[model samples]
Target chain A: MHEYSLVEALIGRVEAEARRRQALAVHGLSIRVGELAGVDPELLRTAYETFRAGTVCERAELRLTTRAAAWVCPSCDAPIERGAPLRCPACEVPARLVEGSDALILDAIDLEVP
Target chain B: MCTTCGCGDTELVPVELHEKILAGNDRTARHNREHFLEAGVLAVNLMGSPGAGKTAVLEATARAAASKGWRLGAVSADLATDHDAVRLERAGIPSRAITTGQACHLDAELVHRALHDLPWRQTDVFFIENVGNLVCPAIYDLGQAANVVVLSVTEGEDKPLKYPVMFKAAELVLISKADLVPHLDVDVAAIEDALARVMPRPERIVVSARTGEGLDRWVAWLERRRLELGLVGRIAGLAGHVHPPGARGDRPAG
Candidate 1:
């Protein structure tokens, strides 16, 4: 899956940032995954464990936060429930998805510096 | 104790990055979009399951576009062979193939590299036939003006509902192999109903690549899309655009 590739990118980013701060080691990593992002959190965790053996994140705690999918009605500005029809309940128009999908943000990282 | 500086205690700091995991790929996709726009080419990303006749549709579209004096180019992706690219070239279009050894989907970086290998300047309509995968391809954007998903009559009508992510991301859906409808138990209406349930007002075209059944309508839709993307002078002298066949009714291939 593409999770491995994303993990590798995460490693690279974390390493670059750690080096910039003259950090000795990494302690933890916080990541946010959206429901509609098409990424499985379990798979991502497995990838992180497998690929973090020799990287700066070798001993870092991986904290993953998954967000739910939400849709906002374009016509009536109402929040539609997840798994509901894409149409707005108020105005009966197609709602726009404001958030809860397509997010893969690396929220924060803990680094051990001298 | 700090191992690096012989300090009494280690100082831990929290860094806020707040960056996307696929930021690199998205940046490259954005650049590719600018490049395509600058070249005045209409790039269409064609995606679907394997054996869904993605290549066949490309071939038919290539031939039809050629007769109208329009230039078309394609970049096909597969895990192992260059067969699809060869087939497109045989159809008289400038084509190239990207062989992604272990990867299941085509990313923007690979397509960017493939763009350099083709004569994109002379191309009016460019097509990227992604690796025949319905799942992974929907997650990656190849900087195309449109994402078209192909589904054949042989596949069950519940495909759209089963693979909602792919169907939802697609701008257009092509129900290929319409010629085999009468010989099979597939229900076209059921497929349309499924698509409607998953997607909001999805645009669809039913075609049979074997007999050139809906080539005119398909080409007319493509022409309109290209013109909308500001490819005015490039497609000006091409064959007059045919009006898109009206209504959602399916026509049995003759």
Candidate 2:
């Protein structure tokens, strides 16, 4: 539901960055959304489709990648496996998230520069 | 359609910019956090499902807050109306409400704007009742010092597991409406156990607004956090800004 807002913001941010870089138009957009970022990839795609019209990103191909923040041992820095115990088998301590957050990062932009 | 050379007089340059898409939101949230800190207020974000008894929990806590001589104010965000704010007002907490037209979650910007309408400076504790949706609200930071989720007993015990993001974001979970637990087949212990699945050691307490059960512990939790504010005024350091490795610093807001 908030995908529209996020996409709207994404397009605006991307367009502004493109203009700042003196690009004629954006040709490709790349973004990474963490699974815990609460953005559904399919829904985000739909939002991007709806919101990209007439913007600098119009006709621009969007490359969206999604991932999860890993849980790692706080003491040993060992990565915890999926479906594994919350504790680190090596460290024998509870595991913690590598990044407790999942903020989406705009990776790169392919722009049509003048 | 390009000519034989396929030249459109435009060079396709790849700009390697690794920046957060929600950087804008994060900057605003950091600003909001600074504002709250400056006002000497401990802001709490209360989120849950629409009928999860968020407002009711606040209502239940109002009397305790009053007796403790705590200045309380609330900013309520709902999709359609300011009814939640009114409910808080009736319960003796001064409140301002924002009706999010289409946004499913109350972003930091909305909370920032609403601060002007609220008595933020005079309040000891400022509660922002996020729009009643578990999924979207968990992702956005409203610059609150604490994030508390209310899960009523009427809801499924597996909610914490289903909505791990929301449950994980919460510093504390309230098993709201504990009085109704006897009538339903829901198990409070199971809910707590499910919370532990997502949050290694989930900090939770069961409560009911109707019978005043477990509210004392709830108030104590708030009191403990409020007291800690003196020692940790810079909630800015708590979790607002965690830059990724080699990531660029904040972009100047336009």
Candidate 3:
């Protein structure tokens, strides 16, 4: 999986935050992956499992959620359903993804602070 | 019952981060963009398949840019060889080679380091010729104002349909090796239609480095896009674009 590098980046970001906050240990973490981010959750989870050991996230549980790409027609305000093609079923123009999708985000970190 | 089994955790505080996993890379890429602007350079992230003729296109581009007086710099990446850099330099473009080793794509760190190796003062347009893979390269932002994908006729027309994410990431698609169109049974229109289905519908220009087809169009696109991206104005003001206050994720150091 291309996930190995992504896992490396993910772990580093968490480690940086853990160090900055003076956390004793990381207990848990939650992340949001967009559908268009090209990351499979299971693959990411497995990748994370391999890389997390021995890091600040060694004992931390990962919670992953997917953010659906909210596709809207160029002219329409309403969103098309999930899995819709890149077209407005109604307007037939082009579809655009609203903000907040296509990103892999760390939602929260459960850390043990001194 | 809240365990799910962290099971009666003693003292774990929930810290809200909402940070993007790519935020670190994004931050560095933003810095690279500002640095490019400092030298009046416009950057392009060029990505494509392994044999999609990216080096050939750059060679052709160098030849085309000469008459127009466009100064081009390249940071070329491959898994093992510096052959592309050699080829580009032979073509008269100032080029640096980055051997990515096991990495399938070029990240901001490599680009940042490679930037120093380029002749910044001589470069008005810089190209980060990404490790030639259609997938991983699209996900990376190398501080480029334009993302161009090169797809050759040999690769087939339906590649964009099969690889949506990479195609979707492109701002421009170069249909390379157009000289082979008459011999091959591929339908260029089908390729264009597939791209239209991709979100943001990237603009495409068909070109052949061998026959010099559409190279002028490609060069003109670069010239037009450089202006569109406001390189001149950014370079005019000594202290133009600063890193956005929140562009960096919230670490105390940030």
Candidate 4:
């Protein structure tokens, strides 16, 4: 899965951060995945587990949070819920996606420092 | 000695680093985009499933564009072979093949490397035909001006619904193999309906590369896109700007 490649990128970033902070090891990582980001959280965790060996995140706990896709009404600026009609509830006009489509963020990291 | 933790002399710190996981790739993609824009090259990322005629469509397009005196270049990615690149070269276009050892999708970094290998200045329109899988490629940004997803009629009409991410990410969708429609049980209308349901007002084109059925229309669309990207003047000296086929405005057939 593409999750493996993403995990690899995540590890690279974690390693760089850890090195910059003079941290000995990473204990945990918190990530936010958006629903429309096209990533599987379970697969990402599995990939992390498989690839973290001998790295800074060897024993790091991978915590993933998901964000739902959001759409905004162009006519009235109302937030439209996912799976709802594309039309805005307030203005009865087609809605536009404003945010929540991407969430590949590493919110925080727990590390063991000197 | 740490006051907060009982463990002897070991400090456990929680660092607040709000960084994106794919930031590296995104940064590279942005760089690639800048490179293309600076060169005035219209880079298009062509994506489709294996056997979806991605290469065939590119080959046909290259041939037609060459005939019109427009210089085209291509980069094809696959697990192990250079066959697609060879085919494009045979069609008289400068092409390179990025042999991804085990990568499923072509990332921006790989594409950036491939872009350097090509004589991009001489090329007006550049196409990056990504690996055949539809799932992984949807998430990757190849720094292309447009993402064109091709689906053959032989594939099920529900493919768009089945792979919503790919369909949703597509800037344009091409339903290939229109010539085979008379022989197959495929319903092109159903495919269009499925795409419309998943995609937000998708611009779809139906073409048959084998019989040159919609090649003119496809080229015309490419020419229009080139003009929109402000690349017409750059290539005008080489190609003299042929009139775009009138069929370019033909809507996706129901």
Candidate 5:
């Protein structure tokens, strides 16, 4: 159910672009969901099917790429790997989360030009 | 050279969107920020779990700030009901109860509409109290000048560690309901320690509305941070349009 809401956001964006281009249909969509984005890819795919029915994105193939969270410590300036409870492994300080945690751009949509 | 053209292996061309999906939402958030600026309003986003005394805190803020001649307005978000808004208005500030209607988080678009219709010009400060959620609300920016993470002293110290993102992202950490601290086993030191693990040790204020403790410091903090809210709104209006993909055609013929 949580994933459904994110899926709705993704679908809504694609539909907006689709309308703008006067696209016949969305053939496929590519998205990169960050590991720390707090979204489940499988659940997103499932929810996508439900919301896409009778929509412009109907029959669109959803391609997802999961990115791991990356952090850089402020004091020591070392990269840290993703962990459940995030912290700097080197300095043990709270790592300044640099990137790979954002719920970012739903990459691109493959459209059938009208 | 295009791969299909096969002109040469030395030349490479890449087609990428390089655009954020949340960009649209961010743009709307920027708009909301500008609206707050022109109106000279301070929007503080209050986030925490359900029953974390978010509404209670707003009530206290309204009452405390009112004496200082700071006109306050609050927008309380929930899945349903304006109960929190109703109670907040009784504090003598005009409050709006927002029913998200199946939406888990309050997005920027919704806040934009709320601001447009809100009495932004009349209020000196505006508080957008998010739905009682620690996780989802962290992702959706409500265009607040500062994000305040409210934790009841009764919720235990490890709360900051458990919900690290919310605590870490907050500009301020408020330990609410200090009245219950005497009876509870809440280790204030441990909470402070946990907070240091996730974020730079932020200004921590402990307050109990009933006891009237730490209210002055809280009000002072609001006064200090008031200008930042106006800046938030102004920046949003300045960034009015986004350049489309490949729209920046100007080049020096490199």
Candidate 6:
């Protein structure tokens, strides 16, 4: 799965950051993913564990912030709930998807500089 | 071995490596995109569930391109066998099969390799027919000019709602197997309604590959795109310069 590859990148970025900060141990890593990002959290977590086995982040925790697929109708101005092909409910217009979904951001990391 | 400060032991020291897992592929994908731009070739990545009639649509479309004299080639991704490639080759277009072993989708690296291995210097348009899966392929980039997501009426109308990412990412949507509209219980309107919600308004084409239904519009659409991409001009420049003699010949080379 592509999650494995994504996890590898995350690990590499964190490792680099850790090295720059002179951190001896990383406590955790945080990522924000949206509902519509089309990624499976379970699979990603599984891949993360396997990938972290020999890395410094082996003992670090992963924090994920999930956002929902919410939208505001460009025509009706009504807030659309998270649904397949998100649409506006009130005016029957194609709603403009706002921001809870389709996110793949590496927000921050927690580490102890020794 | 561990007698002296345990230094002789295979120390399992864990190095903290925090990273996004998709970073590697994303880097490759970006490289692949740049490559397509440099080559001046448009790549269209096709994705959909199995039985969505991807092959049939590709076959009909390639056949229609014959009279137009457009240089078209295809790389069909599957887990095994070159059946789809053979089918496309029979239509007088150069095509190849990409077996992904047990992988579910076509990744950028595979496509990058395929481009180098194919007769890229001759062809103007290339299509990467991804393995028949909706979930995995959407996440991988194939250095495509456009991404097409094909849906059939036989599948549930809630498909778009169920798989929002695929619908949203697609530049075009083609509803296949439309000839069975009368027999099936599909709510075409509902599907469109769902698509409107999740994605920007995408060009929607309804066609039945079996009966040659709605081929003119589809072909015209392709022609319009070809014109937009300057396909004729690009191929003309390469006709005598790059294309292999056999490929440039009037007869089908393969």
DockQ of 3: 0.43
Candidate number of the best DockQ: 1
Better of 4 and 6 by lDDT: 4
TM-score (C-alpha, index-matched) for candidate 4: 0.87
Q: What do the candidate models score in CA lDDT, each in turn?
A: 0.84, 0.82, 0.82, 0.83, 0.73, 0.75
- Which lDDT value does model 3 have at B186? 95
lDDT of 3 by residue, A18-108 (tens): 8998888899999998877867778899999998888988999999988776768769766766544577777776678877678788889
TM-score (chain A) of candidate 4?
0.84
Q: In angstroms, give how far residue B188 of model 3 lies from its true place.
A: 0.5
Pick the lDDT winner. Answer: 1
Tens-place lDDT per residue, model 3, B29-137, is 9988777755567889999999999999999999887887777889899999899999988998889899989999998989998866666555778888999888788
Docking category for candidate 3? acceptable
Candidate 1 docking DockQ:
0.56
Q: Which should have the higher TM-score, number 2 or number 3?
A: 2
Backbone clash count for every predicted candidate, in the order shown: 0, 0, 0, 0, 4, 26
Give a tens-digit lDDT track for model 2, residues B1-254.
Answer: 23558766767888888887778998999989876765557899999999999999999999756677777899998989889999999999999989998888999999988877766777778899999998999888878899999999888988887888898788999999899977999888888778866775578989999988898898889889877776233233232333324332232211
Candidate 6 on B83-149: residue-level lDDT in tens?
Answer: 9999988976689999988888887888878877787646666778999987878877666767888
Q: Predicted candidate 5: what Cα RMSD to the true structure?
A: 8.0
* CA shift of A17, model 5, Å: 3.0
Which pairs clash in model 3?
Answer: none
Docking category for candidate 2?
medium
Task: At residue B209, give the lDDT of candidate 6.
Answer: 90
Deviation (Å) of B16 in candidate 2 = 1.7
Off by over 4 Å in 2: A78-92, A99-103, B1-9, B231-254
Per-residue accuracy of model 5 over A11-109 as CA lDDT, tens digit each: 788888778766667788888877556566788788888888887778888888887666677888877644333466667666667666655657678
lDDT of 2 by residue, A1-114 (tens): 888888988998988888798887888988888867878889999999988898999979999877776878898898877645457888777778766347578889998876
